[model samples]
Target: MCKKKPYLLSSIREGARLGIQECRNQFKHERWNCSILPSIYTSSSSLSLSVLSSALASAHSIFGYELTSGTKETAFISAVTAAGLVHSVTRSCSAGNMTECSCDTSLQNGGSPSEGWHWGGCSDELQYGMWFSRKFLDAPYKNSSDSDVLSAMHLHNNEAGRLAVAKLMTVDCRCHGVSGSCAVKTCWKSMSSFEKIGSYLKDKYENSIQISDKLKGKVRRKEKNHRKIPIKKEDLVYTNRSPNYCVEDRKLGISGTHGRECNRTSDGPDGCNLLCCGRGYNTHVVRHVERCECKFVWCCYVRCRRCESMTDVHTCK
Candidate 1:
């Protein structure tokens, strides 16, 4: 319910768009897709945003960023937001849009390189990104003693997201010799696409840690837990239990799966058997048109004929 305005509204909006789009793209195939829209009667606003107000008001609330009872959603949002911040700022720095930062030149200044290391391209602007993101995104949790448990979990998950990005940093290299001969090379630390980051976070979500109770002002797992190992800094953490998500619950922020399309052949969560929540599904035939029998013209364009196809569509009742 408390929203703080970030610096650089225009740039933040652009960054938010990138983050939201990436989240949606990553969760498209999943059941709990990252949607920004808030129900007309829901009390909780998913995201701490202020990320995209116009779209939010227009009914596209997007990935909920606020810490909720649902640990999975909270973990994902925190990670995605951090990842988004890193992705956007790094891109902006490389693109020369921001005046405050520029291409990473740390390696060019006598930094020791390991074997097979040719660090001479624009290094990933992760340092700047992490700093700026910490300042911007951590504003809400700073100077607050109340909600220590929730705040700690969120902060941990946020850092976990950043760590995910760092873990995925790769050495991007290109040969600089004529005909690609074995000569000089250019390489830089590059980040994986946001989709990959999301997938990684999804795995983290599946294996998220549960905070049984606060121990000496720190989160501790319950003994006798299946995951007996100590939690890693990169692990996602949650305090509250999640809902079943079988029916609509506005306060819980679950829209339910009714009327949602399901794949009949799929055996996963998206399968009709599971998605419908044992309520059964309704099927109907849908017709669509497509371009077919296209042939390339001499050296110009090509023409194609229209073709019609029909397929069965299934939706949860």
Candidate 2:
């Protein structure tokens, strides 16, 4: 068994805190930068940071002189609104499912693009950091009916990784796992009638189960909306992370290495489709299918143990 390293856990916690901080800073700066683009776009930093800085620079020579702050702000607002309108089409490009575009024709035809859209397709890249898997169960909670998906992910995974997932996949957790129309009961083999009867008797479980009255309504200190640091009036100010992360010996760990259960990747154990070990333990990415299916491969699935909601990957052959 691998012993939990205190420093290692500390480092992980620090990294999460830092990433959250960085994300907030980036958004705030991006918004502030839009307000200053008229005077700043031609500068070297804007080259790849955003906007075809190159195109904007070339137009600068002909257009001559900088844009006023109001002009920059107006253009920035238009871009944001346009991008939001078109985000559904743009974001699905990488995943090979972009028909849900923001085009007027598509919208008028009673189609919604907000199902999945991101601007400039910038979310396609993977950053160097921790990743997680989230699951959504059919019921508002978990029970024996949900074990199969969890077990299947385990079968294709290492001992340590499986054990961690087993405990972590309870009520209050979310997941992106291998769930099909068939009950997630006893995969690879059917169960006896007695076992099935027992399954019906178990309690429904939820990802966000109430721990207790005191902690129930309490929010995670870190997940709360950040108190925006006020910018200094005299300096060219950049946002700084909150000082809470500076503690000397604070430590944290996920229920499993992947952290929150609801916060899972779209791909199940098969997301990577590789033999590489997941963080803290060994795991192999794979697609699990029963011989019973006709259209079995190349589908993304999400499972919720609570409602016992298992999506259909394909019809049984």
Kindly report which residue stretches of model 1 are placed more than 4 angstroms away from their true locations once superposed: 1-11, 38-66, 109-117, 224-228, 295-303
User: How high is the lDDT of residue 36 in model 2?
Assistant: 22
Give per-residue CA lDDT, model 1, range 67-137, as digits (tens). Answer: 45536667767777777777777777777877778788887654334433467878777887777667767
lDDT of candidates 1 onward, in order: 0.70, 0.22
Candidate whose TM-score is highest: 1
Model 1 clash pairs are: 35-62, 36-60, 36-61, 36-62, 37-60, 37-61, 37-62, 46-64, 47-64, 47-65
Q: What root-mean-square deviation over C-alphas does model 1 reach? A: 5.0
Q: Write the per-residue lDDT of candidate 2 for residues 53-139, one digit (tens) a residue.
A: 122212222122211111222222212221121221222332444332221221122322253221221122111110111111112
- Cα TM-score per model: 0.83, 0.15
